[model samples]
Target: MGSSSLSRWLRPEVYPLFAAVGVAVGICGFQLVRNICINPEVRVNKEARAAGILENFTEGERYAEHSLRKFVRNRSPEIMPSINGYFTDPK
Candidate 1:
């Protein structure tokens, strides 16, 4: 098609649609880069390993256990028995 015909077909109303698509594409590209390139490495605590808090078979499980132990340790002592009960008791 001629440039004039194409320009006539692509009206001003479609500019907003193009702008929205461009913004969406830009956001997706930014997130893709952020996830792949700019991701921060998680530093595992040496103390947790020394204390045997992360002795689980898998790395993910070990990290989870270590996080739970750290969470419990940081909380009040009174809450320990209840937290412990949740694991020990059936109900």
Candidate 2:
């Protein structure tokens, strides 16, 4: 009974499902951490918000923008930036 149950749980066909679940969980965890720690619009103080924190920021402008966006904005998009820069740089 133990072997049968273990074999059923360890089937090769179930690996994809496990991979998908793991990817989904990783994405959820990343988003949760980002929202809690870095998202500017998540105000913890109701009073401060009411008083004037980010009052001038428009709704569209309030969302936290990833620093990567700014870094890539002026540069041409590349699949591997470090490698591209390494080869292209003058010695």
Best by TM-score: 2
Off by over 4 Å in 1: 2-5, 40-91
Q: Give the alpha carbon lDDT tens digit for every residue of 20-69 in model 1.
A: 99999999998777555433333245654356443334755553456558
Candidate 2, position 67, lDDT: 67
lDDT of 1: 0.66
User: How well does each candidate superpose onto the true structure, as a TM-score?
Assistant: 0.38, 0.52
- Provide backbone clash counts, one per model: 0, 0
Q: In model 1, which residue pairs have backbone atoms overlapping below 3 Å?
A: none
Put down candidate 2 lDDT per residue, 27-83, tens digits, no spaces.
999999877665666656677567655654554354534567677789877899899
Please give the RMSD to the true structure for each candidate, in Å. Answer: 15.7, 6.1
Residue 31 shift from truth in candidate 1, angstroms: 0.2
Worst 10 residues of 1 by lDDT: 35-44
